[model samples]
Target: MTDTPTSRATLDQVGASVTGFFQDLGCELLEYSPDRAVVALTLAPRHLNNAGNLHGGVTATLMDVAMGLCGTWTEQPEQRRVAITLSMNVNFSAPAAADSRVRAVARCRSGGHKTFMASCDLLDESDRLIAFGEGVFQRGALRSELP
Candidate 1:
Protein backbone atom coordinates (compact mmCIF):
# COMPACT_ATOMS: atom_id res chain seq x y z
CA MET A 1 0.00 0.00 0.00
CA THR A 2 1.07 3.58 -0.59
CA ASP A 3 2.39 5.52 2.35
CA THR A 4 0.21 8.35 3.57
CA PRO A 5 0.82 10.91 6.29
CA THR A 6 -1.26 8.76 8.63
CA SER A 7 0.91 5.74 7.95
CA ARG A 8 3.99 7.86 8.41
CA ALA A 9 2.70 8.87 11.82
CA THR A 10 2.11 5.24 12.67
CA LEU A 11 5.60 4.42 11.50
CA ASP A 12 7.03 7.11 13.76
CA GLN A 13 5.10 5.74 16.71
CA VAL A 14 6.44 2.26 16.12
CA GLY A 15 9.92 3.64 15.65
CA ALA A 16 9.75 5.45 18.92
CA SER A 17 9.45 2.12 20.71
CA VAL A 18 12.91 1.30 19.39
CA THR A 19 15.83 2.86 21.21
CA GLY A 20 19.57 2.59 20.86
CA PHE A 21 22.17 3.26 18.19
CA PHE A 22 19.44 3.89 15.63
CA GLN A 23 18.26 6.84 17.65
CA ASP A 24 21.86 8.02 17.87
CA LEU A 25 22.03 8.00 14.10
CA GLY A 26 18.94 10.20 13.92
CA CYS A 27 17.13 8.01 11.43
CA GLU A 28 13.41 8.25 10.95
CA LEU A 29 11.08 5.66 9.44
CA LEU A 30 9.19 7.23 6.55
CA GLU A 31 7.40 4.18 5.22
CA TYR A 32 7.30 0.41 5.51
CA SER A 33 5.64 -2.71 4.15
CA PRO A 34 6.15 -6.44 4.33
CA ASP A 35 8.69 -6.21 1.51
CA ARG A 36 10.08 -2.72 1.71
CA ALA A 37 11.11 0.11 4.01
CA VAL A 38 12.15 3.72 3.55
CA VAL A 39 14.07 5.72 6.13
CA ALA A 40 15.35 9.28 6.17
CA LEU A 41 17.97 11.34 7.93
CA THR A 42 19.62 14.70 7.61
CA LEU A 43 23.36 14.80 7.53
CA ALA A 44 24.84 16.45 10.58
CA PRO A 45 28.34 17.47 11.55
CA ARG A 46 28.61 14.32 13.60
CA HIS A 47 27.91 12.26 10.52
CA LEU A 48 30.65 13.79 8.45
CA ASN A 49 34.19 12.58 8.03
CA ASN A 50 37.20 14.77 8.67
CA ALA A 51 37.54 15.20 4.92
CA GLY A 52 34.15 16.97 4.97
CA ASN A 53 31.76 14.44 3.50
CA LEU A 54 29.26 12.02 4.99
CA HIS A 55 31.02 9.16 6.69
CA GLY A 56 30.93 5.76 5.05
CA GLY A 57 29.93 4.25 8.36
CA VAL A 58 26.89 6.50 8.48
CA THR A 59 25.82 5.38 5.02
CA ALA A 60 26.36 1.77 6.00
CA THR A 61 24.29 2.27 9.13
CA LEU A 62 21.43 3.64 7.09
CA MET A 63 21.61 0.68 4.73
CA ASP A 64 21.74 -1.76 7.59
CA VAL A 65 18.75 -0.23 9.33
CA ALA A 66 16.67 0.12 6.18
CA MET A 67 17.42 -3.35 4.84
CA GLY A 68 16.93 -4.98 8.21
CA LEU A 69 13.48 -3.46 8.47
CA CYS A 70 12.68 -4.61 4.94
CA GLY A 71 13.29 -8.17 6.04
CA THR A 72 11.63 -7.92 9.43
CA TRP A 73 8.25 -6.43 8.56
CA THR A 74 5.16 -8.64 8.63
CA GLU A 75 1.65 -8.26 7.24
CA GLN A 76 0.53 -7.92 10.82
CA PRO A 77 2.59 -5.24 12.50
CA GLU A 78 2.14 -6.88 15.89
CA GLN A 79 3.45 -10.12 14.44
CA ARG A 80 6.61 -8.49 13.11
CA ARG A 81 9.93 -10.15 13.82
CA VAL A 82 13.50 -8.92 14.16
CA ALA A 83 16.77 -9.80 12.46
CA ILE A 84 20.50 -9.46 12.90
CA THR A 85 22.80 -8.61 10.05
CA LEU A 86 24.79 -11.58 8.86
CA SER A 87 26.51 -9.62 6.11
CA MET A 88 26.18 -6.43 4.14
CA ASN A 89 27.83 -5.26 0.91
CA VAL A 90 27.69 -1.56 0.16
CA ASN A 91 28.86 0.53 -2.79
CA PHE A 92 29.40 4.22 -2.29
CA SER A 93 28.87 6.02 -5.56
CA ALA A 94 28.79 9.63 -4.40
CA PRO A 95 29.14 11.87 -1.41
CA ALA A 96 26.52 13.86 0.46
CA ALA A 97 27.42 16.98 2.34
CA ALA A 98 26.56 17.66 5.92
CA ASP A 99 22.97 18.96 6.29
CA SER A 100 21.74 17.25 3.16
CA ARG A 101 18.48 15.38 3.43
CA VAL A 102 19.06 11.74 2.58
CA ARG A 103 16.85 8.75 2.16
CA ALA A 104 17.40 5.04 2.06
CA VAL A 105 14.90 2.78 0.36
CA ALA A 106 15.25 -0.94 0.91
CA ARG A 107 13.54 -3.83 -0.83
CA CYS A 108 13.52 -7.46 0.18
CA ARG A 109 14.85 -9.69 -2.54
CA SER A 110 14.31 -13.03 -0.90
CA GLY A 111 12.89 -14.36 2.34
CA GLY A 112 13.01 -17.76 3.91
CA HIS A 113 11.94 -19.27 7.17
CA LYS A 114 15.27 -18.46 8.78
CA THR A 115 16.89 -15.80 6.63
CA PHE A 116 16.28 -13.03 4.15
CA MET A 117 18.19 -10.93 1.59
CA ALA A 118 17.55 -7.28 0.94
CA SER A 119 18.91 -4.35 -1.07
CA CYS A 120 18.81 -0.61 -0.46
CA ASP A 121 19.57 2.54 -2.44
CA LEU A 122 20.55 5.70 -0.62
CA LEU A 123 19.75 8.99 -2.21
CA ASP A 124 20.47 12.63 -1.52
CA GLU A 125 17.89 15.41 -1.54
CA SER A 126 18.82 16.04 -5.16
CA ASP A 127 17.81 12.45 -5.87
CA ARG A 128 21.33 11.38 -6.68
CA LEU A 129 22.26 7.86 -5.73
CA ILE A 130 24.86 8.26 -3.04
CA ALA A 131 25.14 4.67 -1.92
CA PHE A 132 23.52 1.30 -2.40
CA GLY A 133 23.79 -1.99 -0.61
CA GLU A 134 22.69 -5.59 -0.30
CA GLY A 135 22.40 -7.47 2.93
CA VAL A 136 21.79 -10.89 4.38
CA PHE A 137 20.01 -11.26 7.70
CA GLN A 138 19.07 -14.11 9.96
CA ARG A 139 15.89 -14.15 11.98
CA GLY A 140 16.41 -13.51 15.68
CA ALA A 141 14.49 -14.71 18.71
CA LEU A 142 11.50 -12.76 19.90
CA ARG A 143 12.53 -13.23 23.53
CA SER A 144 15.45 -14.62 25.38
CA GLU A 145 15.61 -18.40 25.01
CA LEU A 146 18.55 -18.74 27.34
CA PRO A 147 18.21 -19.71 30.95
Candidate 2:
Protein backbone atom coordinates (compact mmCIF):
# COMPACT_ATOMS: atom_id res chain seq x y z
CA MET A 1 0.00 0.00 0.00
CA THR A 2 1.12 3.53 -0.69
CA ASP A 3 1.65 5.88 2.24
CA THR A 4 0.65 9.47 1.85
CA PRO A 5 1.41 11.94 4.60
CA THR A 6 -1.51 13.97 5.91
CA SER A 7 -1.66 17.62 6.79
CA ARG A 8 -3.53 18.98 9.79
CA ALA A 9 -6.10 20.62 7.56
CA THR A 10 -7.01 17.22 6.17
CA LEU A 11 -6.90 15.10 9.29
CA ASP A 12 -10.50 14.04 9.02
CA GLN A 13 -10.13 13.30 5.34
CA VAL A 14 -6.99 11.30 5.91
CA GLY A 15 -8.53 9.44 8.82
CA ALA A 16 -11.43 8.41 6.67
CA SER A 17 -9.15 7.26 3.86
CA VAL A 18 -6.98 5.10 6.09
CA THR A 19 -9.81 3.22 7.77
CA GLY A 20 -12.64 3.29 5.33
CA PHE A 21 -13.97 0.11 6.85
CA PHE A 22 -14.65 1.98 10.07
CA GLN A 23 -16.78 4.38 8.07
CA ASP A 24 -18.54 1.48 6.41
CA LEU A 25 -19.27 0.19 9.91
CA GLY A 26 -20.74 3.56 10.91
CA CYS A 27 -17.75 4.51 13.05
CA GLU A 28 -16.75 8.19 13.40
CA LEU A 29 -13.86 10.01 14.94
CA LEU A 30 -15.48 11.66 17.89
CA GLU A 31 -12.40 13.25 19.40
CA TYR A 32 -8.63 13.06 19.23
CA SER A 33 -5.60 14.48 20.91
CA PRO A 34 -1.97 13.57 21.26
CA ASP A 35 -2.67 11.22 24.13
CA ARG A 36 -6.25 10.05 23.63
CA ALA A 37 -8.91 9.30 21.05
CA VAL A 38 -12.61 8.62 21.04
CA VAL A 39 -14.50 6.78 18.32
CA ALA A 40 -18.14 5.82 18.04
CA LEU A 41 -20.36 3.56 16.03
CA THR A 42 -24.07 2.93 16.05
CA LEU A 43 -24.84 -0.77 16.16
CA ALA A 44 -26.80 -1.96 13.19
CA PRO A 45 -28.07 -5.28 11.85
CA ARG A 46 -24.90 -5.63 9.83
CA HIS A 47 -22.87 -5.23 13.02
CA LEU A 48 -24.58 -8.06 14.87
CA ASN A 49 -23.46 -11.61 15.39
CA ASN A 50 -25.65 -14.68 15.31
CA ALA A 51 -26.71 -13.96 18.89
CA GLY A 52 -28.46 -10.77 17.72
CA ASN A 53 -26.12 -8.48 19.59
CA LEU A 54 -22.99 -6.51 18.79
CA HIS A 55 -20.27 -8.74 17.46
CA GLY A 56 -17.11 -9.25 19.46
CA GLY A 57 -15.00 -8.48 16.42
CA VAL A 58 -16.74 -5.16 15.97
CA THR A 59 -15.92 -4.13 19.51
CA ALA A 60 -12.37 -5.30 19.05
CA THR A 61 -12.01 -3.30 15.87
CA LEU A 62 -13.34 -0.18 17.56
CA MET A 63 -10.91 -0.58 20.41
CA ASP A 64 -8.06 -1.21 18.03
CA VAL A 65 -8.84 1.88 16.02
CA ALA A 66 -9.19 4.07 19.08
CA MET A 67 -5.95 2.90 20.67
CA GLY A 68 -4.05 3.02 17.43
CA LEU A 69 -5.07 6.61 16.91
CA CYS A 70 -4.01 7.48 20.42
CA GLY A 71 -0.49 6.83 19.25
CA THR A 72 -0.83 8.20 15.75
CA TRP A 73 -2.27 11.46 17.00
CA THR A 74 1.02 12.08 18.76
CA GLU A 75 2.78 12.68 15.49
CA GLN A 76 3.06 16.15 14.02
CA PRO A 77 0.17 16.89 11.73
CA GLU A 78 2.55 17.67 8.90
CA GLN A 79 4.10 14.23 9.12
CA ARG A 80 2.12 11.29 7.93
CA ARG A 81 2.62 8.06 9.82
CA VAL A 82 0.82 4.90 10.84
CA ALA A 83 0.88 2.77 13.96
CA ILE A 84 1.43 -0.93 13.44
CA THR A 85 -0.24 -3.17 15.98
CA LEU A 86 2.33 -5.42 17.54
CA SER A 87 -0.06 -7.04 19.99
CA MET A 88 -3.59 -6.52 21.27
CA ASN A 89 -5.79 -8.06 23.96
CA VAL A 90 -9.53 -7.59 24.13
CA ASN A 91 -12.16 -8.46 26.71
CA PHE A 92 -15.87 -8.41 25.96
CA SER A 93 -17.52 -7.46 29.23
CA ALA A 94 -21.12 -7.27 28.03
CA PRO A 95 -23.31 -7.66 25.02
CA ALA A 96 -24.42 -4.50 23.20
CA ALA A 97 -27.75 -4.84 21.45
CA ALA A 98 -28.53 -3.50 17.99
CA ASP A 99 -29.26 0.24 17.55
CA SER A 100 -27.00 1.10 20.43
CA ARG A 101 -24.55 3.95 20.01
CA VAL A 102 -21.29 2.59 21.32
CA ARG A 103 -18.18 4.63 21.88
CA ALA A 104 -14.57 3.56 22.26
CA VAL A 105 -12.29 5.77 24.27
CA ALA A 106 -8.57 5.07 24.30
CA ARG A 107 -5.41 6.60 25.66
CA CYS A 108 -1.73 6.07 25.17
CA ARG A 109 -0.82 4.74 28.58
CA SER A 110 2.92 4.56 27.88
CA GLY A 111 5.43 4.74 25.10
CA GLY A 112 9.02 5.04 23.90
CA HIS A 113 10.87 5.85 20.70
CA LYS A 114 9.73 2.85 18.68
CA THR A 115 6.72 1.53 20.51
CA PHE A 116 3.81 2.63 22.63
CA MET A 117 1.13 1.05 24.80
CA ALA A 118 -2.52 2.08 24.68
CA SER A 119 -5.73 1.07 26.43
CA CYS A 120 -9.36 1.43 25.43
CA ASP A 121 -12.85 1.13 26.87
CA LEU A 122 -15.97 0.52 24.80
CA LEU A 123 -19.08 2.11 26.23
CA ASP A 124 -22.70 2.21 25.22
CA GLU A 125 -24.66 5.42 24.68
CA SER A 126 -25.81 5.17 28.29
CA ASP A 127 -22.10 5.24 29.27
CA ARG A 128 -21.90 1.64 30.45
CA LEU A 129 -18.78 -0.31 29.78
CA ILE A 130 -19.20 -3.05 27.24
CA ALA A 131 -15.66 -4.04 26.36
CA PHE A 132 -12.02 -3.22 27.06
CA GLY A 133 -8.78 -3.60 25.14
CA GLU A 134 -5.09 -2.79 25.18
CA GLY A 135 -2.48 -2.91 22.48
CA VAL A 136 1.22 -2.50 21.82
CA PHE A 137 1.95 -0.50 18.72
CA GLN A 138 5.11 0.12 16.69
CA ARG A 139 5.57 3.53 15.15
CA GLY A 140 6.41 3.23 11.50
CA ALA A 141 6.12 4.76 8.08
CA LEU A 142 3.61 3.57 5.57
CA ARG A 143 4.92 1.15 2.95
CA SER A 144 4.60 3.93 0.43
CA GLU A 145 7.27 5.83 2.26
CA LEU A 146 9.87 3.25 1.33
CA PRO A 147 11.96 3.99 -1.70
Candidate 3:
Protein backbone atom coordinates (compact mmCIF):
# COMPACT_ATOMS: atom_id res chain seq x y z
CA MET A 1 0.00 0.00 0.00
CA THR A 2 1.04 3.62 -0.61
CA ASP A 3 1.90 5.86 2.31
CA THR A 4 -0.81 8.29 3.33
CA PRO A 5 0.05 11.90 4.07
CA THR A 6 -0.43 12.91 7.68
CA SER A 7 -2.59 15.92 8.44
CA ARG A 8 -1.21 19.27 9.62
CA ALA A 9 -3.17 19.22 12.85
CA THR A 10 -2.00 15.71 13.63
CA LEU A 11 1.52 16.71 12.72
CA ASP A 12 1.45 19.75 15.00
CA GLN A 13 0.60 17.54 17.92
CA VAL A 14 3.54 15.25 17.20
CA GLY A 15 5.72 16.24 20.17
CA ALA A 16 3.32 17.88 22.60
CA SER A 17 4.08 15.49 25.41
CA VAL A 18 7.71 14.43 25.11
CA THR A 19 9.07 17.73 23.83
CA GLY A 20 8.79 19.84 26.94
CA PHE A 21 12.49 20.63 26.90
CA PHE A 22 12.49 21.47 23.21
CA GLN A 23 9.35 23.57 23.50
CA ASP A 24 10.79 25.38 26.49
CA LEU A 25 13.84 26.03 24.35
CA GLY A 26 11.54 27.93 21.93
CA CYS A 27 11.55 25.29 19.21
CA GLU A 28 8.34 24.82 17.21
CA LEU A 29 7.21 21.78 15.28
CA LEU A 30 6.85 22.72 11.66
CA GLU A 31 6.23 19.35 10.06
CA TYR A 32 6.40 15.73 11.20
CA SER A 33 6.06 12.37 9.48
CA PRO A 34 7.61 8.92 9.23
CA ASP A 35 9.72 10.13 6.32
CA ARG A 36 10.75 13.52 7.68
CA ALA A 37 10.33 16.03 10.50
CA VAL A 38 11.01 19.74 10.56
CA VAL A 39 11.56 21.86 13.66
CA ALA A 40 12.50 25.49 14.00
CA LEU A 41 13.61 28.14 16.50
CA THR A 42 14.56 31.77 16.54
CA LEU A 43 17.70 32.74 18.36
CA ALA A 44 17.42 35.06 21.30
CA PRO A 45 19.90 36.61 23.72
CA ARG A 46 19.51 33.66 26.05
CA HIS A 47 20.43 31.24 23.27
CA LEU A 48 23.88 32.65 22.72
CA ASN A 49 27.23 31.92 24.32
CA ASN A 50 29.99 34.19 25.56
CA ALA A 51 31.13 34.76 21.99
CA GLY A 52 27.54 35.82 21.14
CA ASN A 53 26.89 32.95 18.73
CA LEU A 54 24.37 30.11 19.06
CA HIS A 55 25.31 27.64 21.77
CA GLY A 56 26.33 24.18 20.68
CA GLY A 57 23.98 22.55 23.17
CA VAL A 58 20.99 24.29 21.62
CA THR A 59 22.01 23.05 18.19
CA ALA A 60 22.30 19.52 19.45
CA THR A 61 18.94 19.73 21.18
CA LEU A 62 17.22 20.83 17.97
CA MET A 63 18.77 17.94 16.08
CA ASP A 64 17.82 15.47 18.75
CA VAL A 65 14.21 16.62 18.83
CA ALA A 66 13.87 16.38 15.09
CA MET A 67 15.48 12.96 14.82
CA GLY A 68 13.65 11.49 17.75
CA LEU A 69 10.24 12.60 16.51
CA CYS A 70 10.72 11.58 12.88
CA GLY A 71 10.80 7.91 13.80
CA THR A 72 7.68 8.19 15.93
CA TRP A 73 5.55 9.78 13.22
CA THR A 74 1.96 8.69 13.39
CA GLU A 75 -1.16 10.17 11.84
CA GLN A 76 -3.27 9.24 14.80
CA PRO A 77 -2.86 11.58 17.74
CA GLU A 78 -4.14 8.98 20.17
CA GLN A 79 -1.87 6.26 18.82
CA ARG A 80 1.25 8.38 18.54
CA ARG A 81 4.47 6.49 18.96
CA VAL A 82 7.26 7.52 21.29
CA ALA A 83 10.94 6.74 21.15
CA ILE A 84 13.96 7.60 23.27
CA THR A 85 17.38 8.35 21.95
CA LEU A 86 19.71 5.41 22.40
CA SER A 87 22.73 7.07 20.82
CA MET A 88 23.17 10.45 19.16
CA ASN A 89 25.97 12.41 17.53
CA VAL A 90 26.05 16.04 16.36
CA ASN A 91 28.50 17.98 14.23
CA PHE A 92 28.58 21.74 13.94
CA SER A 93 29.60 23.22 10.62
CA ALA A 94 28.77 26.88 11.26
CA PRO A 95 27.62 29.37 13.87
CA ALA A 96 24.22 31.05 13.95
CA ALA A 97 23.90 34.70 14.85
CA ALA A 98 21.41 36.06 17.30
CA ASP A 99 17.85 36.18 15.86
CA SER A 100 18.59 33.70 13.13
CA ARG A 101 15.77 31.34 12.30
CA VAL A 102 17.12 27.81 12.55
CA ARG A 103 15.31 24.83 11.09
CA ALA A 104 16.07 21.14 11.35
CA VAL A 105 14.90 18.38 9.01
CA ALA A 106 15.19 14.75 10.00
CA ARG A 107 14.47 11.49 8.16
CA CYS A 108 14.46 7.88 9.23
CA ARG A 109 17.19 5.93 7.46
CA SER A 110 16.46 2.41 8.64
CA GLY A 111 14.50 0.60 11.31
CA GLY A 112 13.02 -2.56 12.77
CA HIS A 113 10.18 -3.29 15.18
CA LYS A 114 12.33 -2.45 18.20
CA THR A 115 14.63 0.31 17.03
CA PHE A 116 15.27 2.89 14.30
CA MET A 117 18.05 5.11 13.02
CA ALA A 118 17.55 8.68 11.82
CA SER A 119 19.47 11.69 10.60
CA CYS A 120 18.82 15.43 10.87
CA ASP A 121 20.20 18.55 9.27
CA LEU A 122 20.01 21.87 11.11
CA LEU A 123 19.99 24.93 8.90
CA ASP A 124 19.38 28.63 9.02
CA GLU A 125 16.63 30.44 7.06
CA SER A 126 19.13 30.97 4.32
CA ASP A 127 19.64 27.23 4.29
CA ARG A 128 23.17 27.28 5.61
CA LEU A 129 24.14 24.10 7.38
CA ILE A 130 24.63 24.85 11.05
CA ALA A 131 24.85 21.35 12.34
CA PHE A 132 23.59 17.79 11.72
CA GLY A 133 22.89 14.77 13.86
CA GLU A 134 22.13 11.06 13.72
CA GLY A 135 20.61 8.84 16.33
CA VAL A 136 19.39 5.36 17.14
CA PHE A 137 16.13 5.15 19.07
CA GLN A 138 14.28 2.41 20.85
CA ARG A 139 10.52 2.29 20.49
CA GLY A 140 8.43 2.74 23.58
CA ALA A 141 4.77 2.89 24.59
CA LEU A 142 2.24 4.87 22.62
CA ARG A 143 1.20 8.27 23.98
CA SER A 144 -2.29 7.11 24.87
CA GLU A 145 -0.82 4.06 26.54
CA LEU A 146 2.00 5.87 28.35
CA PRO A 147 0.30 5.87 31.72
Residue-level lDDT tens digits of model 1 in 52-93: 899999999888988988877654454446778999999999
Name the 10 consecutive residues with the lowest summed lDDT in model 1. 138-147
Better of 1 and 2 by lDDT: 1
Model 1: residues with Cα > 4 Å off, grouped in runs? 1-6, 76-79, 142-147
Quote the positional error of residue 32 for candidate 2 in Å. 1.1
Model 2 scores a C-alpha lDDT of 0.80
lDDT of 2 at 85: 91
TM-score ranking from best candidate downward? 3, 1, 2
Residue-level lDDT for 106 in candidate 3: 95
Query: Across residues 96-126, which tens digit of lDDT does each residue of candidate 3 receive?
Result: 9999999999999999888999999999999
**lDDT at 13, model 2:** 49
Full-model lDDT for every candidate: 0.83, 0.80, 0.83
lDDT value for model 3: 0.83
Output the lDDT of residue 4, model 3: 65
